[model samples]
Target: MHQGGKFIVVEGGDGSGKSTQARRLADRLRDAGHETVLTREPGGTASGAALRQVLLEGSLDARAEALLMAADRAQHVTEVIGPALARGAWVVSDRFVPSSLVDQGVGRALGVDAVEALSDFATAGISPDLVLVLDISDDVSKVRRASEDPDRFERESEEFHARVREAYRSLAAQRGWVVVDGNLEVDVVADKIWSVACERLEP
Candidate 1:
């Protein structure tokens, strides 16, 4: 392990299993003699959770929603993530700025550059050491998402998801993220995520 805490981010479209993989990765890190903190975007703290509900409110405009997410991220980073990292504890986030870059930036036509700038401000200089992008087909994502209540983003059309996926791929290529196929079984997907996390965490 390194001197500072490792920040690992997992991102994907709805039903891509990001939450599941994040939890598993946290467990793996804990078992490997390291302290770990598991968190999620839009709801990592009390204020963030409150903002999350507003962000999910059906009446908010797309741009408004994006701004709310930014606000939540800023609070979460300052109150939760930064403190955890300062303690040299590994932080595994189920979703991070990448989600906004895809869903709000590309899918909502907000422009990726604008999204990136907002993310930078919201994150307050913290950057993930490694980002695991779980890529799955829209069909698969939709089928899996069907089991849950359709959020505003999930209710978007298939074309929207395609654009979001493309944005994720492009972002990964530009940012040196590790792209993983999310169509595999839960354990199989976790193993691949574990491998990449281990590679980055080992000194």
Candidate 2:
């Protein structure tokens, strides 16, 4: 049987540098001879992009937000992620199910178990082979976001961000996720993530 491609997920808060690291990992993997597809949640597909706008810009109840995220995820996996993996292209995503678990589950106080169940159904059982969580302090996160136009989640109160960070830490510990210090310089953080990805996914 032909071996399918690996699925890797990079997760973190708004300013935790997940996008940068995800791109770096994908680039490194491709340079090393592996076909790589670098994508992001809430907007990986056309339909997903529409849903992302509603979820981020429109004000909705927590339940509604969670459901929208699940909806986007379903399309993302079906349309983009699954096909790439089937073709033996490594899929490196900026955010995956973990975002729903933290944002809606813990941050929104919607319950992690329920959110996880929804996420499982959304992705149709597709899960990341390796999850790299860029961990950063609340202070660092705030500093990083200060210069940018805050998004819906970024504009959330400090308590909410704190909850999200703690939830990430808890999930990382329980799930054996590879956590990197996002507080470091971009290149340094990327190097650490690259080292782990090479060892686990490429080696």
Candidate 3:
């Protein structure tokens, strides 16, 4: 078992398979005898869920949307993630600060530095110990997204998603985040993520 709980975040553009991989990783960790808590951004806490509806369903301005995301994150970290970590439970989040950076900062043109600073303040310096970025081509993301009911971000133009993906790639490169090939089959992607996560988990 780890001395302290670890925070793991899965990030990707729409339809890049973040949810699936996050669940699989959490399950794998639990089966290995680690206590794990699986959660998601913008919907983890009661207040955050309400904010998520507004952010995803309402026609808010880009700045408003970004602020709302930060608000949700603050609640999530305080109410759910922070407590879990304090008690020694590994927290696996489907999306975290990186999503705000790419979706609002880059895709909406608010600037990455500004979003990063806001997110840092909102979470009070809490950050993921590992960030797994599911990297997929734009074409693949489009095809995968076609089957789902589009959320506010999913309804964005192809150019917007391209920018989001590029920003994720750039951030991952600069931050040394693990980038997984999301175009592969589900089990293949899960195996890859699990392998990488195992390396990061403390014994």
Query: What is the clash count of model 2?
Result: 0
lDDT against the true structure, each candidate: 0.88, 0.91, 0.91
- Model 1 Cα lDDT, one tens digit per residue, 133-171: 999988898898898887777887889888998889998
Give candidate 2's whole-model lDDT: 0.91
Model 1's number of clashes is 0
- For model 3 the local lDDT of residue 146 reads 95
TM-score versus the correct structure, for each prediction: 0.95, 0.97, 0.97
Candidate 2 residue-wise lDDT at 153: 89
Per-prediction CA RMSD (Å): 1.5, 1.5, 1.5
lDDT for 171 (candidate 2): 93
Clashes of each: 0, 0, 0
Q: Is candidate 1 or candidate 3 better by lDDT?
A: 3
- 198 Cα displacement, candidate 1 (Å): 1.2
**Residue 129 miss distance in model 1 (angstroms):** 0.4
The residue-level lDDT of candidate 3 at 12 comes to 93
